[model samples]
Target chain A: MNGKYWVPAVISVALMLGACGSTKERNPAGGTVPTQTSEPYTDRIAPAPAPVDGSYDAAAAAERALSTNIIYFDFDDSTIKPEYQGVIDAFASYLNANPTARVRLEGHADERGTREYNVGLGERRANAVQSALLAKGVSAQQISVISYGEERPADPGHDEAAWAKNRRVQIIRQ
Target chain B: MKSIRYWTALLLLAAFPAAHAELEITVTGGAEAPLPIAIVPFSQVPDVQLDIAQVVENDLVRSGRFRALPRRDMLQRPNTPAQVDAATWRAQGIDNVVVGQVARSDTGYFARFFLIDSISGQQIMGYDVPARSIDQMRYVAHQIADLIYEKLLGQPGYFNTKIAYVSATGLSHQRTFQLIVADSDGENPRVVATSREPLMSPAWSPDRKQLAYVGYERGRSAVYLHTLATGEVKRLVSERGINGSPVFSPDGRYLALTLSFENNPDIYIIDLRSGTRRRLTDHYGIDTEPAWSPDGTKIAFTSDRGGQPQIYEIGIEGGDPRRLTFQGRQNLRPSYSPDGRSLVLVNLEGGRYRIGLLDLATGDMRLLSDGPLDESPSFAPGGAVVIYATQGARGAELATVSVDGRVRQSLRQASGDVREPAWSPLIR
Candidate 1:
């Protein structure tokens, strides 16, 4: 916590750390520093910049919720099982239907990774859903996301059946 | 008073070197050869009939830094400071020596002890502590180890503290959760709460007077704060969406929690004094497990802001968030060491969740816990150890590993499965 680290506290500074994701802003001792100032950050991973339609259609919006556990992933990920296009699509449509209605996406994990890592993973899952919904024409103003860090497991058991259920993205109303 | 004399000795020891006013954890660097030392039983008040010497020796050994000398090999056990013969231990290949005695008080008892450099024949450090002030003899022993640790390692010792964790045990087919508190060494487990439903996230207040955690009852999860003295409990957060993951700042002024009441799950800080809440993260993505650094300037939380469930750091008030973890395909539940210098996190490797420590400096990571499943890693306030949920032989149980992965112990009762283990701050 103290800014000075080169003295007697060398080992502890090394305890709570591991390698970081983006290495652009590395510290002198190699710790990563913050980049974006926004709260609900949406990483700009240029996918040819999807065209902005600026149109709202209730039926056309992505499915707001799904009874299934199928989610989608951008590349290689077991988190938020990516094929959730339908769920994202439904949420997009719901957002278009009611702009005033605020909805939140709760991200979750499969109990496979560290709980804290899964929290960020869950957040990433929720963020991915939010971004995907935005691409399908969902307004950012009405949607929010939070990661539970594997604290709220949909399935409490330790087996695979439970892990699949634990790795999820629940949509909640504000 | 003997205890007061020990306090003065501690103060003098602090003035010499290796004492910290603020509690700090001393993490051992990479796998180095362990240090060899000896702690000879100190003399005590006549007829007191308590030997806390072995207890002090045990704590130091658990640090993974010291190799304690067996009590049977001791050539002598001295009570008075002048009686300590550093040469005797040095001849036995012991590097350090500790000796002490006990004094009786109107209420209970008082004790004084010291650590010496056996090789140099120098008075490394010495202090006296009130045994009566310490209802638990283990804490008094921890103080002895802390003095020796400070004299040698120069970091704040966390031996004289406790950890709060949930223990579960039942029919292998049935599940239950029980909130239990025990010594850092996994001794004296006393249940504070019990139920068939699951209990998660055992967090300690800054003062260590209260604990905040989430419990499941009647099929719903709610956050509750339990007082150790009164056993009185109150709900801090319980809403329509999941309301959980409560962590306290160093100052114990506020608690950062995950709440879905605002539609999307966002991170919020609740004032324990007034019940006022402040929202810190607003991303459409999930943000949970907000851990405060020792200084309380920034919060290290698990967020997928980038696109994966990676770790990120955000300001307490609000501002830009910087990504922290990137090594494994999956990482989360980053708990800061007491000094906020390093983080103990659960990392997913080869399809297993293991405990790992991230050096805030160097961006390098090292695997600490070896297991198929690990979660909810909570750091000791000093950052020397971490307690988290793990899948043991039976079911879910609470396990601990020193930051260096040298010392490991698991706390399991007949309850059912222990999920979250939070280390309490030093208060008493």
Candidate 2:
């Protein structure tokens, strides 16, 4: 049993490292399935396309995505959905290239549960994103996390659409 | 520079009486057969603006125990027990009657009220409460209600109490949070503190002199102890991570709070006098929203260790935590009733978050509030009512429900969303 577990763990680690180094699997179509490793722990967010020329502005590319810089989650969950990997990839790569650039991950929850518990939930969401960014090799110094619980809402409506928008981690560039 | 400007503006706003947004309370539900009582419009000597008798009537009606007979229905306006005609009120099916008179003296004012049982034709209780000014008459009225409540029902009345809550306005970065303390009837709202950042979890000191609450400074959570009399705030705890849920122990010497610095969020108790701390729980799951039992020997808290958030009780000396709530999808924010036999908490069932009362001995849970979203349950001083936060038509607002789950009232403000209501202990 020990040998069986060890063989799969080693293979999974190898696949994760390969997925991190090779750029061919980048999800260009913007779908839920991330093109990187399927493993939840070491899944690398595929960064934005590599700059081709000297005039290419990585800051400009990140700015456009950061304009609507939001990553949403399911009800009462902190697992960064696969669809938000592209947004996280843009943030991680931009922060990695620009070490001086700092961002605050403001996590929020919908007004469903108790307030303090939502604060914990929000922190978990922010920490989840922070882990994702760190797994992609973004410097820890460039990222900070704060959870606003259900105090701040992207949409104040009581329906699921508003709650879905509110359960989010906002990447705020500072 | 922006932070400085915001602090300066907050100080200026706190220095004076900010917007007076009185809570408009509407009784939504009440007992099936309420005791019919008549509160005659009190006769005034100098004709004061504040109606002391009306205030008392509103207080009693809101409790759902008493149904105040309208002034129009009164056959006579009696100002004293001597003037009360028991036969007339008894004929009208009013079992009891409250009559009062407010007289202005050279010093200030004197309000005298009489609670008489029409069935017995005897005065139940009477009191002459002095008010320094007209502004204090409402408080005097609440005192009268409390006396009558205790005399009639044999339970301490919560009328002469206060509630501290967070009122938030604006959206996003422009949001302004004000910690407001108002009378139990939602009158005399005074802004205790203002913050550009979010403020939550207002806990009342046992003496009712100070409040310990969670406020964010520079986008990080910190707990502060604010002296109500001096308007001075002491930053009590600002650990590296998650310093929130500041609840005062029954004796007021310690504060049971949740700090995440060690790792994940866990319950801890801080010796307020010594400024020292001790860890209570070491769970990886979120362990927060701690409440001290009235005896201060045990603490009840919300923890998700059982795969979902539920109420758990543990000894103050750190022992095996016993799970207290087994019903609902989740139960959070456990607050012991003053009697310490039960806990009032936010119970989520069938996707609807409502206020729930849990019996400690039987482990039976009963849903209280009818809610799509109702949270933050705190028992009133007497444990007769539980004031919680619920989503109102305008936005979030403060509400109260009797422990029996009969009386329901919605306290709404003209503006801002109100949440996290902490009912204060009875003022001596």
Candidate 3:
């Protein structure tokens, strides 16, 4: 086009561009345009299944069910408490009944020690739990232990109450 | 006035920085307690913008040998060593005075500091270190403290050194892994590298020019050496399986690393100058955590080759390895003491993973640190203290403990969990 006509042609092209946008272009709201890089994610939240009305009559009849997962130790110590032997026994019975079950003993520590020391400490805590379980007729093959080593705390607040709860080995069933 | 001479001596003592520095000093081998010191204030810098003097005071106090003067108790702050009226400070019982001035520099500022004896006004130590920016001002302050600590204590200060650590924020599923470098106090944390996958194991080059670390990039693991002075990075090993735990030998000639090219992890030494590699271990079990001895002749590593993880020492040249740890059921991450006489290992004893110093001389091991889950003990170059990773709630973090088990302190920063603190070798 001639220089004088070029201006009008440019204006027409600009008008056309203003009217249409590429599919890859996005809105100003930070919402992504549909693109190959974008993966579709589900937005619908589903309710969990309704609970059955049946009761465990035999298990509910048992007196004072003990939580056998956690066991505490003294500072810098991995020795299992004598008073907690009954809980270990109950856990041992449950583990024996469920033969295919695998368990992970997680060890944790209070903030009193160094992190590496705690890793070792956590490992020892888990090791002690594993040994106790093995001593109670549980197969080593059925048990797997990982010392989170204070990496994962059961209670996270920085206080004695939190520490007391953290310094324990937890038996997790998998 | 009763006696101007008496008043003058008292006034001289009061004005001196050494007045607070006179507390009991514990020599490493001695049974004496650390000297109590009063680090009476250096004049506060209004625009200088950092608690510079306070940091010096804290370093001296934290060493366990110099008990620092509590800030609340200073009767008067004499501006300079010359103006220090020793008599008043002697009356208050502070033994030393530290004085400094921070002046603006081209980029940031220059800080000049001096330690002076309260009675004589004689300077014990003085230094002028440039802080390139406000970010480095804090580090420069620590450098000055190191000068003071070394002048007074004869031992090298760990303050000027940088600690390499792995910092992770966010939950486990959405976590970010970053290899970070910061002051030994964990200040001014900056990321060296970041990744969605785990970044583990950091080691310092003996020259302090570069840092070697494990990087998990693009579903592959490799060891990388990053130049701090030049911002250059090089990948040393990116083979199949695990390529991690790179440690530089004392002479800076070779790097001992753990690689799994053959479907198993074993210790391997690479000539940094030639890029040639030689395998150090040939066992079926795991052989990891290789730490070079101070003399660079032998490497101390953790191997389950003995049926359980134990500290073992093998010559750099191929030979039969000798196991160093026999007491612990499992011991990993064995770090050699700089003196070449001791190895600090993660000792699993009564169920706690405490830092244990194994005296190579006596073949005796004592669990030095208390609390739980302590692993990965790295020695301070002078073999005075240890810095290691321990479990904090939520994730792994770092804390330090002295060799004598007396001075234990955490790097009390609010940054997300930090782990694997490898102390850099002396830069100067």
Candidate 4:
């Protein structure tokens, strides 16, 4: 079961490097680029950046993708949203390239439900991300998962906007 | 430097309030009109610091079943039965009158009180209570209130019991969590545990000598049992995956908790003395929040096996799980009432989460709270009231509602969020 994931992990690392090199060549002045790409791998194989307007800068877009660590989820669900999958893929590539790299996934939920059950939901979310990374050839030993439930919130407001930010899995590099 | 800062923060929290600030309660709803009553100022040879009559009055008022007459309305102060003028109280439309006196005794402060029927002009009940110190005087008042409640309402009073809750202050990264135990009326709040990470799911042992809760001290969820008298904390489980929702059995012999070491959350029971764990649920779906039935024969918990979160019950020895809830979008956090006939849980309905009570026999559920975001419904000792956490204007505050859902009161802190209220069992 464990051996099946190593091949994709190696391929994702190659894809990660290729994408980074391509972005640098396209924009020398370090400007932001449109997140979307027309390549076929963008849809099925790898996390494709979102489509943006012509005014988008390539360099800034690349930096934002690389720096973004938090992955948000839908209400009461653990499946990684399509938009956030790219963020998880970036971390997976970084960890696969540097085998010794370690990161901690801290899962959180909003203050809408019971605390303990939210903890379980948070764990499921974190584990979902961990599974994605592991499938990308990131060693299980290099990653850890912890669920903070609704105890920690990125936005403390009780409204939907705040709750959307609170139900997230934060990837912290160790 | 980090250790120093942590200790400094701990010291600041300790210094801020060794005892919990009295929770300001506001009664919002009630089914029946409150009975008019007066608690006369307790006469003392040398007046004590504690206001025994006021504490009793607050307890009665918070119950939403009694209307304590204003002290100014009392025509005269009476300390004994002989001094009581029932006709005067009856003229004032008072139904009952309580009069007491505090006197220094050989062991401690001795308190003697009498409950009088204003209309009948007869003493209904009388008792003498002893307190070791001024701090206990508050508890003495609670005891008196309990007696009065039982006599008039025919239900056990929760005033003399204690409550455990999690208090969070600050924001996000700098948030501080304190596991606090306070009197039922929100007095004498003591910090039993503190951590920069979250501490939650506080369940009092049957004996009230310890608390079993989940803490994130090591950056991962772990179940911990904290002994109150000795200040001793023992970590019961800290495995690779989740270790959350540790609740003691009715007999206090075992702790039912959730662990996901196998990559799926499941319910497990751990014997406290032998340290043996028995897995109860082996399903792939999430199985957590294990609440023991009052008889200890069955365990009710929240599970998502039915496609959405719902309450389910299984025997102690483990068997086919029976689904217990179906009316809401999701149902979670099931806590059995003392009688074991019904359970209270958080039910998501119409996009708003509220507290719901489920009848075990008939499988009928009733929504008991009207708040938008109410959670963690725990039954008071006698099943007369259910205390839960509700989101208020300032932050999350504690609220209590009667079983009939007519009477409601909110216990708000001065600042910070106070939640996860677990009412202690009746303390003799």
User: Candidate 4: which stretches are off by over 4 Å?
Assistant: A1-65, B1-22
Model 1 reproduced share of reference interface contacts: 0.41
Q: Rank the candidates by TM-score, best first.
A: 2, 4, 1, 3
Residue range with the least summed lDDT across 10 consecutive positions in model 1 chain B: B8-17
Identify the superior model by DockQ, candidate 2 or candidate 3: 2
lDDT of 2 at A160: 93
Q: Write the per-residue lDDT of candidate 3 for residues B1-428, one digit (tens) a residue.
A: 43232221111112111111111112232214665555655554566667787877766676666766677877666556676676666666655667777777676678877787666657777777887777677777788878877777788887877777777666555666667777666555556666665566788888888888766554355687777665556777877555767899988889998766664568899999999999998887667788898888999887776666788899999698998888876777888888889888887767677788899989999888764777778887667788877765645566677788777666533546666778887667
Candidate 4 lDDT over residue span B1-428, tens digit each: 33232222221234324645556778887658888899999987575788889999989888888988999989989999899999999999999999999999898897899999999989999999899876688889999999999999898888999989888988878888888888898888888888887888999999999888877765667787777786656777888788988889989999999999988899999999999998999998889999999999999999999888999999999999999898989999999998898999999989889999999889899999886999999899999899999999888899999999888989888888899999998886
Q: What is the lDDT of residue B280 in candidate 2?
A: 96
Task: In angstroms, give how far residue B44 of model 3 lies from its true place.
Answer: 6.3
User: Taking the tens digit of each residue's C-alpha lDDT, what string does model 4 give over A1-174?
Assistant: 233344455566677766675763354445565444455222232356333333234333444566888888899999987887789778877787689989999998988878888888899999999999998889999999998888889998989999999999999888
Chain A: TM-score in each model: 0.55, 0.66, 0.61, 0.63
DockQ (0 to 1) for model 4: 0.58
Inter-residue clash pairs, candidate 2: none
Q: What's the residue-level lDDT of A163 in candidate 2?
A: 94
TM-score of each: 0.68, 0.86, 0.65, 0.85
Put down candidate 1 lDDT per residue, B1-428, tens digits, no spaces: 33232121101111112111111122333225667777667666656654688877767776777777888888987765577687787788888777777777776776677667777777767676766644555667777777777667777677777767665555423544567766666666566676565566788888888888777544345788877776657767767555677888888889999876676567899998999998999887767878888899998887765665678898888998899898986677788887777888878778777888899998899988877888778776556677777787766677667767777766654545566777777654
Report the alpha-carbon TM-score of model 1 versus the true structure.
0.68
- In the range B1-428, model 2's lDDT, one tens digit per residue, is 33232232332235535557988898877887888989898888665788778888888888999988888888999888988889999999999998888887778998888889999889888878998888788888899989888887788989999899999888878888999998898888899888888888999999999999888887678888887886767778878668889999988999999888786899999999999999999899999999999999999999999989999999999999999888889999999998999999989889899999998889888888889899999899888898999998889998888888888898998888988999999976
Give the DockQ (C-alpha) for candidate 1. 0.17
Range of the 10 consecutive residues with the lowest summed lDDT in candidate 2 chain B: B3-12
Clashes of each: 68, 0, 55, 9
